[model samples]
Every structure is written in structure tokens, then in C-alpha cells.
Target chain A: MRPSATWRGLLRPGDYIVLAASIALCIAAGFGLWRGGTPDGLIIRAGGEIFAETDLSRARRIAVPGPLGTTLIEIQPGRARVAADPGPRQYCVRQGWLSRAGAVAICAPNQVSLILTGRGSDFDSLGY
Target chain B: MTHSVIELTPTDTDRRIARHAAAAIALTVAEAAIPLPLPGLKPGLANIITLVVLARWGWREAAWVSLLRVFAASLLLGQFLAPGFFLSLGGALASLAVLAGAMRLPSRWFGPVSHSLFAAFAHIGAQLLIARLWLTPHDGVFYLAPILGGAAVVFGLVNGFAAAALLREKAHAG
Candidate 1:
């Protein structure tokens, strides 16, 4: 193999350590999932509402007021999309819809939040 | 043969540079292709190529390939200057620095697989830092999950295998 051919060779020791730190992230994500083990749930906050309630196979196009501004969110049977408007930015619209449990979209700037909680599954709040 | 310094002709050098640029760009594209259930999480697949290039070619060349890749990816994804970009940059630079230090270690102590695992961990660490510093700071510290760390280990191994495939091709050609 060429000198640079070794993919692992290209990485330094510190790289491994740095990458290992993601273990923490993984743990947190898993914890979020574990504690939130039920399907069909809802999370209401100051920004907006996030729910993972029904089957995504029969969703339809729905207009919504995002925190940043006006948006057209497509709620498909199993997917959702946020359309961009004349707001300051449309990054959130570009984010598309989230399908997985615990998946959430929020426009903090606009105090608008969307969460699709698990469906048919109980909402388990580990603590708070 | 291993003890002697590796030499290259001018043409060979040019070809090598071309290959690195091509590979880096490809990896950058690949990295963007994979999506997570969440907006923030990524497998960091492109870092695999960057890691291999850093290990074999050294930090300077790796820097060139990775730096350009990041900028190009950001532009393509329309995520320039977005929090996502900052997270990626912080992780990448930190990984480079870490890889640079590891290069000094005895080769017998590790293998390509180990190197990949190391880089994966580093990327995650820097990502966390970015999340804390730039992204939402409220309860940001909770972002760390052992599952993500485990994913890094697994993905790093997969990336190592990818780099190894490239190596085999290079060896065959050279």
C-alpha cells in the first residue's frame, strides 16, 4: 500500500481520543430514546408542539406558522416537510420532516417548535 | 525497504496530488449523502478519508484535502456558516491535531483499525465542544450518549476498511 494508503494510518492517536468523546453523545441519545420508550406521544413547550402520534403513511400538506415566519409543512403518511417563506432564513424549512420517535424541529427564534412523538407507544418521561 | 526514505518522481508527485484531491472530494460527497434521524448527527464518513490521508500523507496534505472538502460540502449543502458547519470544522481540526500527535507513536503499537477508532472518537469530542460552544447551551451537556460513542467505534472501523480498500488499489497500481 502507498504511504497514505492506510486509512487508519492517516489518523493520529489524538484523533481516536477525540472521536471517543462521541461515546458521550451516543449515550445521551440512547438515554433519550430509552427513557422515551413509548410510541404515540406529545411534547408541548413554549416554542411549539411536537408529536409522534399516528401513522405517517397518510399525511397531507398543512400550512403552519413557524417561529421564524410562515411555512408550509407537508405532513405525509410517514413524512413531513417545512416549506420556506419570506422569513429571515428558511433553514428549518429545508430540514424536511422528522419521522423517528423523539425527533423534533424547533424555530426558537420564532418560538415555534414541532415534535413528532412515538405512536401507539406510551410516552415515558424518565424524570422530568 | 521500509527503513529507506520513500522517493517520488515529479510526475508521480503530481499524480498523487490529483488522486488525493479526487478522493477527498468523493469522500466529502459521501459524507453528505448519509442522513441521521436527527438534524445534527452524522456518521462522519468523510473523516475516514481525511484520517487515512493524514496518516499516510501527513497533516499538511491532509489539511489541504480536508479543508477544501469541508468548504465545498458546506457550499453544496447550503449549510455554510450554519451551526452544523461549525460543528464539522471544530471536529475536523481537532482530529487533525490529534492525528498529528499520534504519528509519532511506534507503528507496532497500533494498526489502521486502531487509528480509525481513534479518529472517530476525536471527531465526536470536537462535535460536542462545538455543540456546547455554538449551539444551544441549555442542557447541551446532555447531548453526550454512550450510544453515539459506540457508533463512532463501529463507523470508524467501517471507514478504516474503506481506506484499506483504497490502499489495496494503490498498492496494486504502484
Candidate 2:
């Protein structure tokens, strides 16, 4: 019932295989899943509708009208943010610089939101 | 009016299962006292008892001990039927499923270490899946996979060694 006369016997070949495979999986996920590319596009939604989809390569300011008022979205060369919103707290404005893929800024009271898109979408849908 | 008495007698196997489950539950309770930075990150010291039981008895006995430990420990920890309880149940089921298969592997090459490692990986994977589907509902939960996987590997190996040593000592004694 014992692998050896001593209790301190080294791991078997199958044990080594499992350990190696587990380490390999850990390394693969660590390196593969975390390197999200910089976002290149931004989608603006207002009043539960798509206001505009623009490329992040351009630097411009777009004002989208909603139920409350216009929410100003400022887009830089590679990032976007809610520069101003009718929402009192300006929580979306505080988000500041949506540069990563799947990054989002929502001005709930203004009914406007901005989402940054990279080479690919990181999630199917997101809500706060 | 005559009252009939129902006799309850514990079988040998029942007694054995209870003994092993008590040990596993003790480990589970003792392990909870140690503080860790993360919520779900546990060394899973109780699983060493499971591995030892599997090595000594069989997978059925191990499964019984494992499941009993989860339920009993949850009750003892006052987390019964809570989110933490479901997570523990999910993990225990997943690890038991893997061990059911791993136990069939050739014992010469695959023993407590291999079974423990595979079960640990399955344990975390199932816990994360349940957390994502039921609790967090966000794919971002997967971002914790690498860190959890690392812990699984380290703790699984350590527990496997502990189980192997216990089995060796038992073999020497018995």
C-alpha cells in the first residue's frame, strides 16, 4: 500500500504530470488573459439609444441630448471621458479617461453612457 | 394502546464514515480560524483528510466524509445555507467528482498527490463558476483565476504530501 519503504518518497510520474500541467495552465492564464490591448473606439449611448459610435483616433467633443440635458463626451487620441453631464454628482465625469477596453462611464440621471472598445469586446454586456 | 419502539443501530461502515467525517470537520473548523487576505483562498487542510480516507478506504467513503464535512462545518461556522455555504458545496462536489475519476487511475503512478492536485484545481474552478453565475454575474471574476490557480497548485501539493505521509505511517502501523 506504500509507494516506497520511506514516507518521503518523491512524486510519481503522473504526479509530476499533473503538477506540470497545472503550473502550465496558471502561467498561460496569467500571461494570456491579462494583456488587454488599448481601446480604439468609443460608443456613446443616450436615452437608451445609440447616440454615436466614433473612432478614438480622433480628438473631439460630442454633445448628446438626453431626458435631463446634454452630456458632453470628450474624446482624446486614445481615450474618452464624460467631460460634463446633467447628472448632479458627476459620477461618470469622475470616472475620467476610459482608455481600457470594456471601460464604461455612465451618467444615469442624464441617461447617457460611454463605452470604450478595444480590438475586441471583453464582455457581452455590463451594468452597474 | 401499545407503543412500538424503533431501534436504530449504527453499522460498522456508518461508524467509520462518522469517524472520518468528524476528523475532516475538525480540520475544516480549525482551518477557518486562520486569517487570509482573500475571502475564498483557503489552504483546504480538510482535503488532506479526504485524500487519506480515499487512499485508505475508497472514493465512496471519501465522498461521504467530504460532503458531511461541508454541511457540518457550515452549520458549526454559522454559514449554513448562505452564499459561502453554496460555494463550499460547489467546491466539494467538484473535487469529489474529480476524485471519483482520479481514484480509478493506476495507483502505482497516480496516488494521493496527483488526486489531491486535480481535485484542488477542480474545486477552485467550480467555485469560480458558481460565483460568476450566481453571485457576481460578471466575467471579471475570472481575473482572479490565475491567483487562485496558483494557490490551488501550492496547497494541493502540500496537502497531497501530508496525506501521503499519513497513509505511509498508517501502512507502517497497520
lDDT of each: 0.62, 0.90
**Residue B173's C-alpha lDDT in candidate 2?**
98
Worst 10 residues of 2 chain A by lDDT: A119-128
Q: For each prediction, how big is the interface RMSD?
A: 6.4, 1.6
Candidate 1 chain B least-lDDT 10 residues: B138-147
Once fitted onto the true fold, the runs of candidate 2 whose alpha carbons sit more than 4 angstroms away are: A1-10, A40-99, A102-116, A119-128
Please provide, for model 2 over B54-132, each residue's C-alpha lDDT reduced to its tens digit, 9 standing for 90 to 100: 9888989999999999999999999999999999999999999999899999989987999999999999999999999
Best by TM-score: 2
Residue B107 of candidate 2: its Cα lDDT? 87
Candidate 2, residue B49: how far the Cα is off, in Å: 1.0
- Give model 1 RMSD, 1 decimal: 15.9
Comparing to the true complex, what docking class would candidate 1 get? incorrect
> How far off is residue A77 in model 1, in Å?
46
